[model samples]
Target: MTLKSIHIEDTDLQIEVKEVRKVSKIRYALKKLIYVPDADLKPKIITKILTHIRNIIENKVKEREEKDHEIGIFIAYKGKFIKGMVIAEDNPHYSSRNRRAASFGWLYAKDYEVCKELMEACESFARKRGKKLLRGPINFPKSVGGYGLQVEGFDEQLIYGVAFNDPKTAPSLKEFLEDLNYKQDSEYLSMEVTQDRWKSGTQLDKDIKIRYLTFEELNNRKDEILDILRGAFYSVLPDAFGMERYKEIMDLLRNIPSHYYKLPKKIKLENDSVQTEFVEAWKKCYDREVITFFHLAFDKNTDNLVGIITCLPDLYELWKDNPITRVNVDVAAVRKGYGRKGIFSSLNNIGQLTGNMLGITYYEGTSIWNLNEDAIRTILPHGRINRRFYVFQKRIKNPT
Candidate 1:
């Protein structure tokens, strides 16, 4: 794990995952990386990486873990490492789910020069890989730290640990990335909505049937959910699919309510295989009344699922040992032709009415990508935007 240093005059560049493959070497390299949270963090994140960053790389470096998971880029000035970025090299999914871009995430630097240096390192890595574009703040897997640069809603709570920057540092970071020609690839909104006004008022066509997707059904029907998700999402935002999955419980920390220090159940002392618990928990966690939010729409004529929306209790409430008073509407999808035909409304209305009856204070719709205008148009009127994010992109000059 000796450091692989690339000296660029006053700056020192070392990539944690570039060539180092030995497990011990990865640990050594990580321990030596920059840990200055104040320089990079935005409000409410509380330097989460200082404590959790090691886990991110450890899982990726394992012998059987995905190879393109993450490569840490550390920039040092005057013998002191100042900035760091995690570069997602190629992909972690099947090749057909692939996109020709690199993801830069866990971005943090003290100032413009350090930030510039960090970004240049990212472009260099992408170019070598022959990737056409570099885009991020997309920390791998969408479980830990998720995606986006916090461009708005600094005052709001850091719901489900989506990326947030130090308010003082975030604006400067945004200006710097924009100045560096990283165009906005996409934007996402985290919304807080009211539960009022939805009262089972719409009558559905007799040929269409709607019902809450029970845990039993979700357990048996993940393939159906994934199909509905991919078919519905591919056109609006394809790469976002890479950030999502339904094979198991998608994000653990977002699901399980902690009984102690809010310990995550996903962590294993040493295990390379995906645990059976994760798959079972996907259905088990939705067992409560909030399960009503897992709406499924089917063509009664053929009995084929055509639309869906899902949410879970905001376990952050329970992590704090508070009673569950809210749900975060996490994912929604309707197959291509059925998208605008009011399926989501019927689904959402049922959830809202259910929430209102249960006295859930508010429901959050998390991370809705801006490309889905139909979703934006449908959900925006009923809620106010609570948080906003951007994944900036820059076309790279690929030699290959």
Candidate 2:
């Protein structure tokens, strides 16, 4: 049983750190924040961040206990006009946040000053404990949930299964984190997905055929697609190396539900052992029939599945009118030899046309940080780019 406490000046704010699981009331209170009435969520728009808070406390605590890390931090805030709270744990082995690749996710804070104070305490605690780096606003580990802050797109709100934050909060985060020599990192880029890309005449020749994947075929052929995904991504992306690291990758392929979410880190290794399980899980999580996948294969000469794309229809409505889903084309890939052939241009053209026919009014894309540069180029002729977000990273110890 270990604990600690702290206080701020001239305010009711006090922070406490202690260990206790199964806090039921707080969990219920948190649920309220998750679905706060949109009307009450006016002005500051501080909609109850209960979902994030609940994750930090309950699920994350279980993960820490499993990892056997002995230190945890908790804080409660009572400010002049706002009340907030946070919880974090010091456990590097905690693996469920995204897929366990994330070795650090600790120190939760709510408001500006308290967040700053909590980060300071975290830095001091980590320094005293002799840890290498401070890595998260992690919920527990990679498999669970962990998304830090968005330094780039301040105007964009988060989507389902993602974090939503205030723009002002990001600048403060930059100062606090950078001052501590902590680096910034991002997952994927959201590019303007337009319909005009088909102008490249990149579609497969009449000889090459485009086929929709049947559920049975999609199920049976998961391993092959997974293998290509692994091989194509591995050498280029060093972050996704081992099977455990690919757990999230597999999970993503299995459960994207048409509203895609990027992996915590890019996939840098080549191994597709878990693709079957991943796709199966995805099917269970999503029941929207309009969502579909198209896997492009070269002619009968070879059994190669070179070009691929996932298309979602009516996603704009699914997101409750959130513009992020206006029309999303994701997980697009094309093999090396197959490049320059119009495979990707063809896929984007047909995919967007299909989406438009299905009632999707807008088109969008979230590009992984290290994916094919050509795939992006192929989309240029089709649609207009609605947004462009940058990804940045700085190693903590390599500050120069």
On lDDT, the leading prediction is 1
Candidate 1 per-residue C-alpha lDDT over 190-292 given as tens digits, one digit per residue, 9 for 90 to 100: 8888545533225345456675544466657777777777655435463554333453244442354333112133543223332232223233333342244
What's the C-alpha lDDT at position 87 in model 2?
Answer: 42
TM-score of 2: 0.59
Clashing pairs in 1: 1-25, 41-166, 42-165, 42-166, 43-165, 43-166
Tens digits of lDDT, candidate 2, 184-296: 54444555554444554443554454545544556566666655555342225312223322333344345445333322123322234222322332333233332244535
Collision count for each candidate, in order: 6, 34
lDDT of 1 at 364: 81
TM-scores for the candidates: 0.71, 0.59
CA shift of 150, model 1, Å? 1.3
- CA deviation > 4 Å runs, candidate 1: 1-70, 73-77, 81-89, 94-98, 198-201, 214-216, 231-234, 247-293, 339-341, 356-359
